[model samples]
Target: MNPIATKYIKLNTAIPGPRAQELLTRKEASVPRGPFTTAPTFVVKADGALLTDIDGNTFIDFAGAIGTMNAGHCPPQVVEALKQQVDQYIHTCFHVMMYEPYVQLAEKLNEITPGNHAKKTFFLNSGAEAVENAIKIARKYTGRKAVISFERGYHGRTLLAMSLTSKIKPYKYQFGPFAPEVYKMSYPYYYRTPEGMGPEQMDEYILQRFQDFFLGDVAPDDVAAVILEPVQGEGGFVVPSKRFVQGVKQICEQHGILLIADEVQTGFGRTGKMFAMEHFDVVPDLVVMSKSIAAGLPISAVTGRAEIMDSPNPGEIGGTYGGSPLGCVAALEVIKMMEEQNLPARGQQIGERTMQAFARFQHRFPQVGDIRGLGAMCALEIVKDKESKEPDKELTAQIVHACNRRGLVILSAGLYSNVIRILAPLVITDEQLEEGLAVLEGVLEELCL
Candidate 1:
């Protein structure tokens, strides 16, 4: 193999070297195939934007644990907080004994989440749980059973979340008897807007369809909430126009249906804002947060208007591990770190740099069909050809694998799985970011050109 000359990446052996191969063998034998993993090796250590594998190979991490590490891997403040909290006490079971950190974090969320309205916040264990609870609260408050989600949107994997999610192959295939009263609506995909429709026209068209939908399908009065991802994470990083988002909010307002923003993957400075909803100048009645909220901690939260959140009385919601002390402490430190370090502004810089590179790639490669993003949350759609715009799923997979082999960990997104997405940690330095991008550009040149 050609010698690698770099500062961050150190590939002393081929991927899955002896030690990793041994682990991989054991993993295949012991673990189920259902849980998918992008890289085929086990990590020994991770910091900032780099990961070291068990086999002594180091790589630049561009996936950021699927957007869970916006504060970077094991951020010093979060790690230190976790260390201190672990020694003090672990789980007091927020329900049984309660903890100060839980309430503190909730207050912080309520203060920071969009709007000046009086709001309340509660914690959960995962993004899916937050979504489920948000829907539950909306239903209870509105006395409605129907919920509306958009096409190509992804919520999570649990029963109700899976039912609302748009993907089928890995997430929902054969997961029968999905939750009842969940409806799907059309979200604008500007790139794929039908033949002659402009983005504005498409936005209006989709918004108008809601009227017909209320008439033909579930009535607006029966809808409890309309859940949206300001920038669709798993749906190929598709971003909606301000008009579309506001239009949806307006419709929800007219029908007295609550609007829920699912910020699972887009929260915590991923999209140049603390929450993606801020980009549209729309304030959702309810918000679901997780992923980067606690820098990989298994904690999620639902923050909403006070009256709506109070709909679920005592003993109606919450779980044993929700808002564990460790998660709360770590999240507190994460929020402080984000504010002190100004990561949201950093996210904007990353987005600018990445989009510039993507623009260059589009000019050079015929397979580059479209480049789109909202902030640091960016993606490049791979296609058979620019004109046809047929999703090149196979090529997309090949590009991801090639970049991985070259020691740049990346990921693919989109309903068709034909888009390369960048979720690199906000803490990544300019040199590290450029090197990782170089690796990706090289792979694209080799595979797509």
Candidate 2:
């Protein structure tokens, strides 16, 4: 008997078709508008890189739940592990009664994350929680009050993370009285750099600005950590040069300030490397991970040097449901799958292919102002024209909606909301990837050309 070939995607109805429309009505009434969604319809089932709506409209998912499903949805081994965990126990909670899976996952993270130093890890419930706790650990470890995060870098939605985040309208707008002592630093944006300034020059300029910032904004001794996303995610897949990242690390080292790599969106093989820091050959003092950590389970972790992580007292840095048994088991399984399949290499391959496709699109359309990425995490900056490079936020929305209606699920990012980002599962098949890109290309042709 021959195995069935994967069809990948099938759209029998309009995106909201009738069933999704009904659910959308209920969602509007029951759910607040605070939580934003890229896809217009709610999904009933997801597998690998495909999401099936209640209306039977199947979409090739390019968003990957905002970079959470690198191992793809409902991976059989992970699912089995989760089931076994359920049968044995579910919610013991790390604080109340410690579990083996929690410790095991911590050990795995310590071993695999980019570092040779002795490391320790603790779990949390979400990426934001991971960021929040990482800051707490850094502050306690350094005995300082100020934390610096880059402009256009996104941490999370919690008060401290929100305060650290760069975007304003949605993530921060009107939400003042924010966490204090958080300073915004200049991050190099090479594409938007002053004409004639090369990448190296831009990096140098930003490093110099960092020095000036320390002199003007806060004392270096008073700073706890410098947090950054290796490749800015919500800031639109902005890939900083390796020199710049290392420079920041150097500054932190010189000042005795911890460098926190916010790997929440870039860790666990979304990037070509297990952690984006690996690409730069710089090991961060502290690493915040979540998103793809547990195959979409609501679990996150802060992994760092043992000494720094130990700074927080036992009772000082944990929550009731911090490391649920399910999350731990799922994370362990996810890690195993990532290693067994070498998903990072797969992500690298995907990135190359997607970038090639994006390059073609850029050549065909003047509105494609920029095509940038670090790995499989790729994005396109939409513009009103080639020369002006004015962000086309409205056109970006049109492309996103059109793609969704045509059986593709994509997302918009960046402070301007004019960038289209691709976070397709690393496990996505070549055919599926080509098909999804084709859909996007068709949408671009219709709208831009």
Per-candidate RMSD vs. true structure? Answer: 1.0, 3.2
Q: Which regions of candidate 2 deviate over 4 angstroms? A: 1-7
lDDT of 2 by residue, 148-181 (tens): 9989999988899999999997888988889999
What is the Cα-based lDDT of residue 363 in candidate 2?
98
Instruction: Judging by lDDT against the true structure, name the best candidate.
Output: 1
Colliding residue pairs in candidate 2: none
Q: Cα lDDT for residue 260, model 1?
A: 99
Q: What shift in Å separates residue 30 of candidate 2 from its native position after superposition? A: 1.5
Q: CA shift at 201, candidate 2, in angstroms?
A: 1.2
